[model samples]
Target chain A: MVADTASYHRIVLDSRPAGRPTADNFRLEEVAVPTLEDGEVLVRNHYLSIDPYMLGRMSTGVSYAPSQPLGEVMIGEAVGEIVQSRNKEFPVGDHVVGQLGWQEMALSDGQALRRVDIGAAPMSAHLGVLGMTGVTAWYGMTQICSPVAGSTVVVSAAAGAVGGVAVQLAKAKGCRVVGIAGGSRKCKYVMESLGADACVDYKKHADSAALGRAVGSHAPDGVDAYFDNVNGWMLDGVLPLMNRFGRIALCGMISRYGDTPMQLSAHSYLLISRLRAEGFIVWDHLDLWPQALQELTDLLQSGSLRSGESIAEGIEAAPAACIGLLSGENLGKQLVKLN
Target chain B: MVADTASYHRIVLDSRPAGRPTADNFRLEEVAVPTLEDGEVLVRNHYLSIDPYMLGRMSTGVSYAPSQPLGEVMIGEAVGEIVQSRNKEFPVGDHVVGQLGWQEMALSDGQALRRVDIGAAPMSAHLGVLGMTGVTAWYGMTQICSPVAGSTVVVSAAAGAVGGVAVQLAKAKGCRVVGIAGGSRKCKYVMESLGADACVDYKKHADSAALGRAVGSHAPDGVDAYFDNVNGWMLDGVLPLMNRFGRIALCGMISRYGDTPMQLSAHSYLLISRLRAEGFIVWDHLDLWPQALQELTDLLQSGSLRSGESIAEGIEAAPAACIGLLSGENLGKQLVKLN
Candidate 1:
């Protein structure tokens, strides 16, 4: 018999933000956990993934994914153990990762749930490096950027999750990798820890011209490939520095997730330099996930890939963690720990 | 013997313009045509191709091609008959097309010259439908856009050279084509003459939003591919209307070829819709030209392809013709008759 009286804490979207989101937009509440039906599993979420893309879902806008519905559990990915199950494939005591939302307890019907091997890495790593974040970096680097050996490749937001992995992936391909990040500390981490040949501190630059000069000095041969995470002024700075027939993999636009429309002025360079800029979401290419995961796992096991995480203590910290990530306050993959 | 004292009238770049080019930027000069060198051939020009790309060469700004130097023969393409030949490859009376410049007579060493089949089409057609204009259309359509049979395709500047051919090419591929042109007259020609399913008159729409609505009405299913010839506000209007994974062939940016940089605000749609925007110059892909020309020739012979021309008489009219073409005063391929 299931214990239907067990209580749990979950976060819900209280209201949509006008511009940048705040902690007030989310509400934490306690509710009784529902008993699982046949073929359903009750999961006790231990780690919640806080991503830059979550900001897109918070607004009622036309995006790749539908906006998060108001007054519902805030949508996100999480890694947890199956506490109770009637499903044959997933049993109690098995670790799995899924879109379990911002809650300590979740009900799953086995769809979109992947059982994780606990022996492979820590449970929280499954929500960051071994999950969607690593896969996104792999897809953009291998599929879109495809930088040739000895060529110059640049990654924006280089200290962050996807950017950190992308920087290493480019370097592994024997490319001269340059990174762009906010502040000197993140820039140092990108160069020293992520193995980027050089890193540009975007905060130090007065304008796009100054930032472009900094990037140009680091990538003197001209950028052949750019993995873009910030697409506003950051993109503006690198566009004019691209060589003929360059490629730009549009991964994310954290800077433009706000209400104000981003103004771009370097479009003329696209034609003049014969550039190709393509945008993509990792979820759209699920077929290649297995292969990407295998390669990423190999890199991790071999110690070729290194990642950093900034963890917030409980379910209550999810909103603040998300806000910190958007403002570049987090150094790496930002996550919330909930036991 | 080669004529030593034959005088020819040619146009030269007198000065670069601060913004849009005027007739005053060009100076008509009469100079004696020198005797050909050992490997050179003299050609009597028939037609001088007036293309929008010339405006880019007129300025000192970085572009695909080097800036048109001041006090030199105005750079252009022309179809002509070899009048005197020292090179056996190009005999007298042989019709050829080359970068013969804005001059009555030109000398060539046969490096970039291509022989034209004058018997198949008019000599001037080699500079329009059968040449770079048609080849450019083929490349952007077949290579970049690659619209599926039932997909919705959009072409900007649909009454002009490249756009006109691109519209017909998309039609041949069995796509539902929509054209965006400046005036109602051009819009009518785009629909009636070029066989576009619908035409949107950008002039009627006061802003990008209104223009986007007009385009949306014609393409209810959403645009799958866009052939962008005018890349400023025109691109802005069409970008948000694109469906997921839509392709944009960045052929030219006529509106932003002036001094002022074009400001774009719809870049977020690129990432949101997972779009791929690629820029190309036909000259860079010379390897595909032969195949493209062959297909174009077959289409012309089958009466499946039709093109329009706005001809200005004599080399003296090139400057005004170029100015008129840039201002959207021309109907189709703007050319100057030299003989």
Candidate 2:
């Protein structure tokens, strides 16, 4: 059932950006498909995930993982179907999700690849809520934030992929969830769709002090936990509003993924309120992925957890999609649909 | 056994400092000592502990505890001899330690008071190594830092009261300890007296970047745990040097206690390294004090734990001593010997 295509298009890292990334940073190249060896399979990519963390991998700086090598396939997660398989475990026509990069096709040895059930959810959902982003939300929220019933939880980037799921999970735990997003439109989605008790539009505030006042008005009782996605000024704004013994789950610092020098002035609140601020990457907690995915799938099927997507058509749109994602231009999960 | 003196001198808060505290902010007034009631005792304070945490209480801003009430006795911990008592628990001439404030004499109802064994250690030791400062160090090191054998542990303000004990405790655990202090003298004390593997003098470095380089040269393998006492530039300097899954026990932020807007630009290192930074107040962990004190007392008596004190002449010198402590002028525990 394999298609007779000789070559596939893939995006490679052309140059590292000095500040914010641009289209010039990526170069799309057409390469011949390799013959599958024994125990290997060829996958036809369906959806490629465009995440903020990819920016960290692109920069030649210290990140949780090593920087993505220049002149190589841009690193990312993807959901695709096995069109040609030499491995019995991954049979032809089976859908799988793994680190498949920004390509139309990927050859894998079945290692680190999870067989996704397309009957339960859409193929693209495997690149989003039912995949790594969802697991990220679960780990940071359940393990780090750990909000209890009636406790107030504040989520930065609350309309983005991980933050959106985190907001829902905290709300499901019977918490008073307050969301901070860039625009009023996303803030509305955070409140209405994600079931957050209140949402603060950070764009409306001039500085962290002003944003803090807006957050304080909504969370009259101080915040018990903070699920931080965009760290910088958002972290500064929420820290002072945290109650004594509050927790801060540092999931991502999307605000500082570029070369921007983000200043954190309200860190003193960490001692003043006796707070616990812990940073974590989802990849480190791989042992919990199975349990996290099970609960997330149940929530999704039960109509409790909801997610939105902003799809950029074709592999060529991957670079601009990522740039848009960093600027908070996307509503939720930003994905590139491959043809 | 009570002395015939009818009146005693005490220092009270005259005004809250806009920035760093001054002598004018305190008022020395003579007041008549109160007669003992049914469950009361009169204590003549011998040594008053001048801690950095008192600055937080003196500020009008939010702190771990309530701000010190103005025009009242300055909040502090004191070691003294009970001159007279109506309670059976605290007899006359028994040496004790409690929150006796900045005064030559204190009247207590036997609440929150602990009797000290002067035979084990000196009377002033009750105000330093064997008292709240020691307990604070114990809780932060054991509960938060929790460094294992062969780990590289870094302690900021390593020559100070709590940091000195923390340095020794980590050393006892068979870990390589690196200390950060103000000058060459304190750095020498950290290495020779506290038994640290290496000590970095932060005063020699112009900026955090320079200090980080000095620390990196000493701890080439990267820091596993950091017991932070001074949390402004010192914390920024050390954060980038932390290994994966490192723990930072935020014991104090003496640098930011005054009117200083500390800008932490290296906070992204928290997410990059997946670090856990937790702030704690020793008062919350009172349940663990008995266990901590038992271990500390054993270590002290066994000569495993060592501490130094810079004692001022009398209660009149308490204000200057505190000011000096904040500036990193005090070599170790700053205390005022009250007469």
Candidate 3:
């Protein structure tokens, strides 16, 4: 008799809806795990990433990163251990990173795969500070903004995955960093826990113009570099207040990610005025990766950098995890695990 | 009886108002010509620049060059003879360049004044090609964009003041210059007369998206550097077709200069998608001006660089001339002559 073997759960994109995403759009399905190919590895996902940028991928629209097609496996990066390996470069029992989909068992090519080092850092951190989040912060602050010592650097979404790392890195470089997060607790975490010079609770600010004024108030020296993750209104304040030749490293626009098509047309002042802003894809700077990784790894090794992971229990909660990610409920890095 | 006190005719901004400038917005007034001071020279107005940039001066907004306040003499550059001089550096009858008012005679400190020998080139040529217009084109194209030989360089407002010089300059540098102009006549002038590599008639080309496709057809290599003068919707089309690492020099945005307030929100797809696009005021590179001026002057002397101008007869025609300049009706540098 044939073996009765199947992974009994899958999160399917149920429908393409308007504006913000809802729990109803994602449907859970029972499915059979596929066999691995000759040159493939089978991975049981240990963690799934929940990023604001994922909200961009969920919608079918034009963006720097192409969105996931409706009814397709929602695209994201994940960390897991290799259950079976047929590729010469990879072996069984290896802790690996791959886009293994929102499922229990999946096949992957050796392409874009890297072994996670539990000795270098914690296992869960591969989804947060040591992974894409850490790299993004490293690249945006150092490469895009390139703040000098004593320059006042401001980062939005301060307590989130990328913001937390950027704040600490900027602090290490002698820059005075200000973070804008959602709550007083997050603000305290940014200032005391992450070494930011100050943090603003944007939710209490009432408007972005007011938030910008508050940021300006904190840095009487004028803002030298603005690391923008949240777009829409708060950016309006910072743009006018940016010092001459000030640089804005635009990593992502989380606020506008889930809005309808019409929201795209309301902000031209970003380009028209005297400000200079640049957006980049991470892979574009592959040559800098080794150096960046070395520097960040050194910082991690010395305990100068700290990280947090909002770990969800299993593969079944991935949909709710995504919803929580978009709503800003998840603190630091949001990750999902399945055994 | 009043010792034949010299009075000169001038245009003054009567009051700041909303929308496109009208004849009534400026008033013709007669003012007493001031005597030269210790470091000043008295210049007789031979020619006055009537540029589209002046349209912005009609408003009270901030700019690289401060705006002229209401009841103040409209500020501009003039190519005039040093009819009177108290400054030992500038002797009378010397052909001088100065920021004299829109008047027959005026007093000015020797700041921004240059005594040019018109035996090599026309006095008005200095005002257009060898002066600010020429310097703007040279700096914006060579220094900012850095178009290499064999790259595709696209220029908008092709047959106008800056466009005319940019075409010749790009061609001289071995770049294939494609121009976007308004009509068949301008297209013919841009290609046949000024020697543009190709010309695109934006008005005849339906939507800007289709226009971009057509322009790309001629420039299969895609755009290398975009010397932008006209912004708004035309800018929308050009943004998508630029090659990776393409440079855009924002010297002027004529489309947005009119009195009408624009709800100018553009999509993320417009500009941020490009790998590199930067904007700067030309004066930021003033330290290199002496070298840039010497190089351009050498080109002008050798007939390698050229210029074109559209001159209006009298001071009364200045308002209509400015309107025509805004509408892209005049090709080359639009100027008003007062003998």
- Please give the DockQ score of every candidate, comma-separated: 0.85, 0.79, 0.32
True contacts kept of each: 0.93, 0.86, 0.22
lDDT of 2 at B64: 76
TM-score of 3: 0.87
DockQ of 3: 0.32
Order of candidate numbers by TM-score, starting with the best: 1, 2, 3
* A57-130: candidate 3 lDDT, tens digit per residue: 67767666676777767677888778778997889888887676776666788888878887888777877788
- Candidate topping DockQ: 1
The CAPRI classification for model 1 reads as: high
Write model 2 residue lDDT over A39-132, tens digit each, in one string.
Answer: 9999999999999988888888777888999999999999999999999999999999999999999999999899999999999888888999
> Candidate 2's error at B165, in angstroms?
0.8
- Candidate 3 has an lDDT of 0.77
* Candidate 2 TM-score, C-alpha based: 0.96
Q: Global CA lDDT of candidate 1, please?
A: 0.91
Candidate maximizing lDDT? 1
What range of 10 consecutive residues in model 1 chain B has the weakest lDDT sum?
B1-10
Considering lDDT, which of the candidate structures 2 and 3 is the better prediction for this target? 2
lDDT of 2 by residue, B177-249 (tens): 9999988999999999889999998889999899999998999799999999988888999999999999999
Best candidate, TM-score? 1
Clashing pairs in 2: none
